[model samples]
Target: MRIGIRPARVVALLVLVIVIPLSVTSVAGRFMGDRVYLLNSTPCRVVVMEQHDGHEANPGETVLIKSGFVDRTPTMMVFSGSAFWFGGLHFTTDTLQVRDQADIAIPPSWLSSSIMGKELTYELTADGQLLVKGPTMQPSMPQPKGLPLKARATPDSKQCRRG
Candidate 1:
């Protein structure tokens, strides 16, 4: 005798198969993505040679994060996902400078470990150790600077990275 397959049962099974994994993935991503922040303390804008996976943003280029006017509302670059999470992103540390001020040189070790400060999604793992999560949306602010970065040759006398 052939077994009768109920439509409702098939739908339920399909929902369980699709919805469960999606919900789990979403929840895991929300808690597993480390937050990367770059707070610009100076009055002048801070420019970073940023490397991001999205070609629409910058690809592997520079971005100018507007300077913070007041301490209460500081301008910052809050990047997550492979952009700031992955420590091996070499193209990112290529440049860090303040307009009409000074350039900051990043050490190889720092670059390898990622200069951007991170808030662990889970305390148990290293920053960017798990990238099951990536940035879901691009915010209105922090758009990549349209103009190309100007060359700076002055002594990299300023320290830009701070905890």
Candidate 2:
């Protein structure tokens, strides 16, 4: 058999093969990308706290926290004018204290790990507010002093309600 080489035919064949696949892939990717899919079904827990000093909080202000961990306990504290909100698994020896002047707010949606060893500790002012001090990761010093309140008083009070 005798074969003749044609540059034009070879080029056309290569273009057709490459372009067809590329076009198909691009279209498929676009369609698939728009369809939202859950990559994983693992559950996550989140806790949030907001605190203010003797100064009252303004309306329409909101605080949020997002957490993701395979096997870890989380704790949060919120302080309002002389109040505080605390949630999550905390050790008994862990101190639950806050500044007296600060207010606290912990949302009802806050969650703690159900694991047996998990413990949550919280301290609040008489108005049921959280008294948070220092950094969220590690707060070394106590917050400024305000009027002391009981954590039980305003267990479910919203942040806007702290007057």
Candidate 3:
């Protein structure tokens, strides 16, 4: 007769009961939000080139942070932008103005981690190129001084997806 259960069996059971559920829960959490943090490792100025969707203010602009990234320079930067999703990376996102910028414009996120609070660092070459630890996406620095204004509505949707 078995005392209770073998140690190996117990371990396996624990993994199935606890570890597996935890893993599944974590993975599923990604859908909770599309937040992200972008860091710049470039020497030159980084700038947002394009953004596709999720703008509540301007339908024409596509995103509010396109012109928001703070001096995406090589020296060092992090997104500080905010959005309906991602944090305006400690660096920037779309609108480097207002309160910096962030987004559902999902970026290359960290492992086992939800897209939320994901820190995606990038590097820029001397000639204006891009680099990163994994898949890359973010804004550049020194975006015009103030936020670009449009007559339609206003600089809304720091939450952007420049995809």
lDDT-based ranking: 2, 3, 1
**Model 1 whole-model lDDT (C-alpha atoms):** 0.29
Model 1 regions more than 4 Å off: 1-5, 33-163
Comparing 1 with 3 on lDDT, the higher-scoring candidate is 3
Query: Each model's TM-score?
Result: 0.25, 0.20, 0.25
> What CA root-mean-square deviation does each model show from the true structure?
17.2, 17.8, 16.4
Minimum summed lDDT over a 10-residue window in model 3 is located at 60-69
Alpha carbon lDDT at 137, candidate 1? 42
lDDT of 1 by residue, 82-108 (tens): 133212221223233333434433333
Q: lDDT score, residue 60, model 1?
A: 24
Best candidate according to TM-score: 3
TM-score of 2: 0.20
The full ranking of all candidates by TM-score, starting with the best, is 3, 1, 2
Report the lDDT of model 2 for residue 27. 57
lDDT of 1 at 55: 17
Per-residue CA lDDT of candidate 3, range 34-125, in tens? Answer: 22232333222233422332222222221222111223312221221321122223233222222233211223232123334333333332
List the pairs of residues colliding in candidate 1. Answer: none
